[model samples]
Target: MLKASSDAEALRSFLMGYQNTSLTYQTYLKELERLVLWCAHVQKISISDITSDDITAYQQFLMLPEPKALWCGNKRSKRLKSGEVNPDWRPFASELSPTSIKKTMSILDSFFNYLVQTQYLKGNPLSVNKRRKKRTQPQTIERWLEKTEINTVLEALSEMTEPQADAFSIIRAKYIIHTLFYTGLRLSELTNHRMGDFTLIEGAWYLKVIGKGEKPRNIVVVDEYLDALTEFRKAIDCPGLPAFNEKMPLIPMQDKLNPIKQRRIDQILKWTFEAGARRYETLANQEIEEGPKHLRRASKLRKASAHWLRHSYGTYLVKSGCPIEKVKTLMGHSDISTTMIYVHIATNDLLDSAQGLSLQEED
Candidate 1:
């Protein structure tokens, strides 16, 4: 059924379908490229020849990629430059976590299914189930900033200087942070959306976005977000509120003519996070009694990223009594199960509710 003799050729064909969406294309390319490399180099087998046992071995390999010197590279290492593959490039950055392994397996399953449907392969090896094991506890979401840490980051942003050279960048960073927190839009959604996507329906505003799987959804725009948008526009010398069908990028480049790339967005957030961490470190030194607490917050802020804001958004909403279904919609989660992780944030409230229960009879 397969026309492509090499796994590399098959991977190229499969990824071609996703070329229109850069984010998805990149993700698929990363996972599939690693798999092809592993099949050729480590397993000495073709992708079409992989079996259920081979998949099990692959899963174990992901847990701890063997011969780290040959399979792993530093996070900043480049895979390609000027259309040439770098010799230092490695498939694995570090050992994959259980969640990461699951995600990689899911992506591989989809890839194999696509191949099967297109007659490129016979069947998906990943679909063959092994003996069932006892179900383990669900992993809790941990990569989110607490409310106080978020406030510290906000304070750091507020203290940023608006020099003529960096005025637009500073304001844009502020808007990006607030939008991610309030709307929970994924990184790609934020970059792809245009100012025109913010529409007024009746009296309220909503930002329309094409989320994961090309699903369209409108996220409600709160007053604070609108205000941030206004500030961002003013910084860029556009209208205070976006005009109807305004074709400007939601987050523009320094030129104010092009949309900021995802890499730039990541860099901006990283800088902001580091700034917040530094600010906390300074506070820690100043406030002797609260030094330990401040130091801990500084450490967490140092580790925060753009996705952390998304998690923080969902968590804060669940904490604020927002219904799970509504949170799911706002988060663009296709499955309620994906949204259930935020429910863990309510453990304290759930415990508080139990305070009313008593073993002794009440009068």
Candidate 2:
């Protein structure tokens, strides 16, 4: 139903014409718009004429600039100092990170493929092979919160007084934190959940997640999660609700009937930090620290983010003697090779492989 004024707009229109109900479609449209702008700035060509090299050139352009310098806020809004925000503040170039770049590339590639299908273009130029840099092999760096620090975060939550220390608010913070660490669901995935997505079947709980591509996958829930769910339900008066009401959000916003969004999540995180949970307060400000290498205190703030929990689950699976193939299935990885990264992190079974190495420098 959308109209196009330019080649990029036309392409976006074509994309919109397809199955376009999902959030990913909007993401694709934004990426395409950015790509079109980048192409316009650099090559000064219409989208129909862009070659694969233009795409590669734009990728190179992206890595040169540092990221933006928004102050990563603390509980008291303290400005923790860091390096300059990226100098390349251009609209298309400034917003791109490695992950975002990858996403953009994928969206454009798909768009181009659509052009091919429609016979608007003869061939796809972005199909050309390019060698990506091989970064150094990763070494296992300890990144999880210590048991004592977990206690510290909890104790800080417990120590809140008066108006700031509402029991439901405190419970919400603890559950959200614990759920992320224990379940390893992505932030969007967790927040997007509805009450109907969870079911208790024969005393076992399961999460019916609408993951990438809107594919439904059922994740098994353990006892701890069951307890959390039970507690949350009791707090929210779950028994009174209609069983099949798709409108009910699993985690509703505080004092509202609607589902909690990312803004609420951010507020909860800020509240956690303000309650003397100093380490947790730093989650928003995490970046690659440049310095002489030494073992630094593990930042619970960094470790407690949504993806860290996923990483923890993968790493723990590897460490706990689960086969890589099984772990891949549990993690819902589409590619076995993609799942192999966790294999390297699992230390116990790889001792024999490690024994084969000999490091004698030539004299």
Candidate 3:
């Protein structure tokens, strides 16, 4: 609470110890900021005094969303630029989805665990009960592209006419779309990429990424993806292979030398999805109109996001006889259970015994 600086210092020191990616730090900071604000304003207790009951209330706030007055302030000032202190910030914009709730809770769990390890707090209050609710259970099979959908998207990208005025942007979008599908990198990892992140090891191409939890991972890609990357770089007048020691942005901004932000990447993916969706609609015409309102009615590229391509990557790998554990390592999942979900993809080989072997006595 505002009454003392000791708890604040403890939290600050704890966050200072974090070596995770910037996005992770931002997310954790925001989550803890919400906790501190709630504790100070509503519970009238210090952070050190928070209980399971408080955590339960916080869960409710995440599910129902805080009142507009509580979390609907102006955007954080970029001029200030201090990660720890944001003068105008709101923790919640809307109700958290089940997945979101779990994500937030996971961050908080790590926070309290850190506090406990540092001997700053007695115990973690949010480790039990509320998070165990069925609402947060991960679905067995999440959304991913079918083989037909994948081909449709490729065809659409291939059909892009040359000599367009926005040639650079078009080619860049094609490369990014393919990379996302091939690498299965999270949006943050993709945006955080640098020119030095790529390497040619043993005549194979690999991309080094700082993924979640500040873990470094190497993603191996085939020659086609590497070829596309080289083509894009050469189009922009860069070296065929990115320099290992260079600090230049991997996916550079047109005007600035810096890398583009996640929002811009999201825009690119959205455009790609819509384009592919339109192509699929044309290829498989139906009665329904092809627009946002009726877009969900179609399968394939309908309502897909960049992450769907990632899921498709995992799904494709698992369906193609890759072991779940191997996929887990490649995908950079700390928990194999998270990777196991890919095992249940619709395309998994079905045993013949599952089909009826019954022979009728009198047909």
Top candidate (lDDT): 1
* Decreasing TM-score order of the candidates: 1, 3, 2
lDDT per residue (tens digit) for residues 1-363 in model 1: 546777777877888889987777878888987888888888999888898888988999999988988998744435465767678777776788776788888889889998888788888887774343357797689889887887787788778875522766677777888889989988888888788999999999999988887788889999988898887788778889988988888888877779987768878887888888988999999999999999998888877778889999999899999999999998888889889999888689788988898789878
Q: Decide which is better by TM-score, 1 or 2.
A: 1
Ten consecutive residues with minimal summed lDDT in candidate 3? 291-300
lDDT score of model 2?
0.62
| TM match of model 2 to true structure | 0.70
Order by lDDT, highest first: 1, 3, 2
For model 3, residues 154-176, the per-residue Cα lDDT tens digits are 66766777753276787778778
Q: Residue 171's C-alpha lDDT in candidate 1?
A: 73
Candidate 1, residue 354: lDDT: 89
For this target, which candidate reaches the highest TM-score against the unseen true structure? Answer: 1
lDDT of each: 0.84, 0.62, 0.74
Tell me which of candidates 1 and 3 scores higher on TM-score: 1
On residues 185-287, what C-alpha lDDT tens digit does candidate 2 reach at each position?
Answer: 6666777788777676786667777765566677777777677766766776666322553556766766536878664776776566444345434432454
Total clashes in model 2, counting residue pairs 3 or more apart in sequence or in different chains: 0
